[model samples]
Target: MITVPQLDQYKDLIGEDQLSQIYDKVRALSGLHVMHFNTTERGGGVAEILQSLLPLLEDLGIKHTWKVVPLDDTSNHFTAHLVDMLQGNIPGQLEAEDQQAFLDTLAQTPILSRPQDSQADLYFVHDFQLAPLTTLFPWLRPAIWFCHIDTANPNQYAKEYILRFLNNYNVCAFNSQASVFKELPREHVQVITLGIDPFKNKNKYITREQGMQAIARCGVDPTRPLITQVSRFGRWKNPWQVVDIYRLVKQHIPNVQVALVGAMEAADDIEANDVLADLRKYAKGDPDIHLLHDPTMIRDQEVNAFQRYSSVILQRSSREGFGLTATEAMWKEQPVIGTSSTGLRSQIIHEQTGYIVDDTQTSADYTLKLLQDRDLWRKLGQQAHEHVRKNFLFPMIVLGYLDALTKAMAFAHAQPNLSGGQKR
Candidate 1:
C-alpha cells in the first residue's frame, strides 16, 4: 500500500503562509465525514483525483470514505450512452426504455438500497454515473454533484433528465463557468477546476537517465524530437487531430516522432477499443507514430517518462473539463500546445505558460517552433511549472473542497428538515 504524504510535505512548493492558511481552514472541517461516489476506482480523472485526494483528507484529520457504485452490464451501457449525450458527443435523448433499464439496474444493486451507506455527513457524488442518487434518496442531505465533463451544450432531452435530480443537491460544481448550464441558479453552482498530484509516480520528479530508460522500454528513441499526448482514447480527446498535427510537424523535422498514450481500461468509457481501432487504421503503419494504450506497457512511471522526455506535449481536446494531463506535462517542465478547450485555456496562459492554438495547423506550427527553439521551450516550461505550483496543485483543490463543505454544512443547519444538521 502506498502511503499518503502529510500536509507539511507541500510547504516547500506552496510556501509556509499558504500551508498555514490551509491548516486554518481544515480546522473548521474537523470531524466531518465526506463520502465520494463514482463509477470506477482505478481509471479516468475522477478516480485518479479521488485516489490522491481522499488520502490527503485523512492526513488533514478529516473522516472520509470512497465508494464505487455497483453497475451491471445493462447499467454500464445506459450510463455510457448518457455520458455521451451529456457531453454532446452524440445526439438524441435517452429513450423511455433506456431510463427504465437504468432505474431497474440501480434497484437491483444492493449498495444503492442500503441505508448504512448514507451515514456520511456529506455525499460527494461525482460525474453523471451516480447523479440519480440525489433523486432516488432525497433524504441524503447536503449532497454535492461534481460534473467533471464538458456540458456547455448537452442534448435537450438529456439536460432535462439530469435537471430532475440536479436541483435536489445542495450544490452543483463544474470545471469552468462555460460548463455551467444557464438553467442552474448562479448561487447553487461552483466552479472548482481539477488538479494533479505532484508527488505521484506519474508526476514525480525523475532523472534524465531514468526518463530515457523508460522511453526506450516503450520502443521509442529518446534521442529524436518527440511529441506526445497523454489521455484516454476517446472522441472528445481528439486523438486524430493530434496525429494530424504530428504529421504536419514531421514534414519539417523528418526525425520527429509522436506518441498517442491513453488508458484502455476505463470502466465508464466503453468506446476506447473502437476509437483505438479507428486510429490504427488512420495511422497506417507509420513506425514513428506510436500508439501506447496497453496497461501493461504504459503505467504511471512510463507516463511520467513520456511527459518528461517529450520535446512538446499536446492536449488537442475538442471538449475538455480541466485537462489534468496538460497540467501534468506543465508540471514536468515541458512546453505544451493545446486547443482553446475550456480546460486547456484555464491551465495554459496563452503565450506565457504554453501556447493555445485554434486549429490543427496552428498547433502543428507551435510544435515545430518549440522543437526548433530551445530558448522558447525552456522559458515556457519554467513558467508552466510555476503556474501549476501556484494554482492547480492538490492543496488548492483541498481548500476548494473545504470551502464547499463549509458552505454545505452551513446550509444544512439552516434547513429544518435535514438530518445531522449542525452549525460548525
Candidate 2:
C-alpha cells in the first residue's frame, strides 16, 4: 500500500477542524484491509469516485485494493442496454445466453472474484452489475455493496435480477434515502451521500481568460450565453433531450450557444456513440450548437474551464447517481439547473443553490431565466459554491463511507442470520 500526507492537501478546502475529524474516523479502521470491486475503471461515476478515494484510503492507513470486473462484449452490451431501460427505454428479457456470458465474465476476472485465494476484512462491491460476484465468492468478508445507480425507479427487469443476489451482501448503501428506502430492507440499507474532490484538476484555480480560451478552443463563442451539460454520453444523461431543450431555449435567445460535451469510455461503449450520432443528425450543420467528442476537450482542465465559462450548467438526468458534475460546477461558482429525479433532487436546493426543474420545457425556462437575469444567476452560483464547500467535498465522502462501514459492522451483528446467506 502507498501512503502519503494526503489529508493536508484537503485542509485548505475543508479546513483543519473537519480534516481532523476525518483522520479520527479513519484511524478507527487503521489496520483493516478493504477490497473494492466495480464493473469498469472509467466511464462511470463509481470508478471516478474510487479513483479519487483509494489513495486517500491508503493515506489514512487502510490497506485497500481496487478491482474492475472484465465484462466482455456480450455482458457489456447487456450492461449498456440495462441502463437504457433505467433511462425509460424498453428492454427485452435476459436470455440464458446473457446469464452465461455474465457468469463467464465473473469467473474469468480473477481479481474481481478474489479470495478464492486470500480475503480482506471488508469487501466493497459497487452496483447491480457486479452483485452476482457475491453469489460466486460467497465467503469473502463483511461485505457491503455501494450502489451508485438510482434504485428508487430501477428497471423492472434489473430490480428482479438484482434481488437474486442482494442477500449476498451484509449491507447495502444508496446515494439518497428518500427514493430508495422503500425499495430496500430497512435493517441493512445505508445512505452515504456522494461527493467530489474540489482540489481536482477541474476544481483547481483558473482565471476568466483561461476559461474563455479553453471554451473557444472547443469552437464555442465566448461572448454568447453558453449552456453546458458535461457527463458521460449515457442515454440516462438525457443528452439528446438536452439538445431539444437547447433548441427551445434558442427560440427565445437567438444567439445563445449550446454545448453537449462528453467522451466515449469503454471498448463496447456504443451507447455514447449512438447518442452522439443522433445528436449530430439533429444538429446537422447548425454552428451555434456543438456536439463535441474530441478527447482533448474532455480533459479535467478543459472541463473545468468550460464549467467556469458556462452561462448555465444543465444536469437534466432523468435518473441520476448523484449529480457529481453538477456539484463540481456548483463548486466552480456556476449555477446548475437539474431535474427532480433521484440524486439531483437532493443536490440542488431549488432556487437557493440552483433550480430543480422537471421537464425540458422547465429546463429551457430556467436556462432563459439565468440568461436574462444576470444578478439571480450570480447569486445562485455563489450560494451553490458555498453549499458544495460545506457538504460535497472529498473528505466528507470518505468520512461517510467509514461511518457506514462502522454501522454496517454493527448491523451484521444484529442480523447474523443474513451474513453470507445463500437464501434471504
Candidate 3:
C-alpha cells in the first residue's frame, strides 16, 4: 500500500491541508470492513478507481477488500447485449424464456449469493451487473449500489427491466444530480462525484520533446494546433460530432489537426469499429486526422505525452457520467472544451476553467479561439489543473467515500433490521 508521504507527490495537486482532512476522516472508519464488488476488473472507470482506491483504503487502516466476479462465459454475449440495452441502444422486454436463461447463467456464479456468507461488515455493489445480489443474498449487511451510468431520465423500456434490481439497493451513488437524481426515488439517492489520480498513468508530467516524439509516432505534426479527444468511442461519447467540430475548426485554421484516440471496453468492439468506420469517412485520407485504437498499450507514455503537447483537449460528449479524460487533460495543463451535459457541466466552469459548448459549431469556435490565444489557453489550463487538483483528486474521492461509509454505518444501525433475519 502507498504511504501518506508517498502520496505527498500530489501535494501540489491535492494540497497538504486537504490530504490531512481526508486522512482524519478515513481513520475514523477503521472499525468497518468494506468489500467492493464490480463486474469488470480492468476495463472502465469503476475498476480503475477500485485499483487505486483499495490500496489507499488499506493504507488508512480501513479493512477493505476489492473483488470481481466474472460473468458466465456462456452468457457473455447476452451480457454484452444487456449492456447495450441499458445504454439506450436497444429497448424491449426480455421474453420469459430469455429472462430464465439469464437467471440460470447468473446462478452459475456464487458471488452474488454469498455476500452475506462473507465476513465483511459492508458491501459496495457497483453498477447493474451485480445488482441482483440484494435478492440472492438477503443476509448481506447494509449494501450500497454505486451507479456509474446516467439514470436521470431512463428509457422507459430499459427502466422496467432494471428496476427490480435497482430497488433492492439500500442507496445509489450517482456522479451528478442532473445525471441521476431527478427521476430516481428521493428515498434512496446519494450524489457523489468521481475523481482521478493526479499522479497516475494518465496525468503524469512529460517534457515537450517527449510529447513531440509521441505525436510524431502517431504521424501527427506537433507544430500545428492540436485538438484531441480520448474516450472509448462509445455511442454516447459522440465521436462523429468530434470529427465534425474538427472539420469546422479546420476551415478557420487550416493548420489545425485533431486526434481521436480511444480503446475498446469489454463487448464494445462492434460499436467502436462502427464509430471507427465513420471517423475514417471524415478523415478522407487526411494524415492530420488520426484514430488510435489502443495507442497507449502499444506505446507506453503516448497519451500522457500527447496531452502534454496538445494545444487544446475536446470532450464533446452527449451524455457523460463524468468526463475523466477532460479532468486528466486539464491536470496536464491543457485547455478543455466540453459539452454542458451530465458530468461535463460540473467539470468545466464555463470560461473560468475551460469552455463549455452546446453544439459542434460552438465547440469549433471555442477550440479555434483557445488554440490561437496562447495566453488565454495557458491561463485556462493552469486554472483547470488547479480545479481538478482541489475537487477530483483520488484523496478527495477517498474522503467522500469515507464520509458516505460513516453515514451508512449510522444509518444501518438505526434501521435495526438491516442485519438480515436478526432484528436488533
Against the true structure, whose TM-score is highest? 1
What does candidate 2 score on TM? 0.91
Clashes (backbone N, CA, C under 3 Å), per candidate, total 0, 0, 0
Deviation in Å, model 2, residue 118 alpha carbon: 5.2
lDDT of each: 0.83, 0.77, 0.72
lDDT at 157, model 1: 80
Per residue, candidate 1 scores C-alpha lDDT tens digits across 88-119 of 64777688987987876765557657777668
Clashing pairs in 1: none
lDDT of 3 by residue, 1-424 (tens): 2247546666776567867777677666876798887777765678778888887777677888777767765455555555556555366655667666876766656755554556688878887666676666666557777767755555566566666665555566777777563444664567777788866766677789978887788778888888888877777788888888888988988888888877565442346777788778867898878887764442437777777788888887877778777878888887788887677888889998898887778888888888779999999999988888778877767766776687667657664222223321
| Alpha-carbon runs more than 4 Å astray in model 3 | 1-3, 6-13, 72-99, 110-118, 182-188, 265-270, 295-300, 416-424
lDDT by residue for model 2 (132-249), tens: 7767776655678877776676567766777777776777888888545355677677778778887678788789898888888887888888889998777778887788888899
Give the range of the ten consecutive residues with the poorest summed lDDT in model 3: 415-424
Where model 1 places Cα greater than 4 Å from the true spot, the runs are: 1-5, 416-424
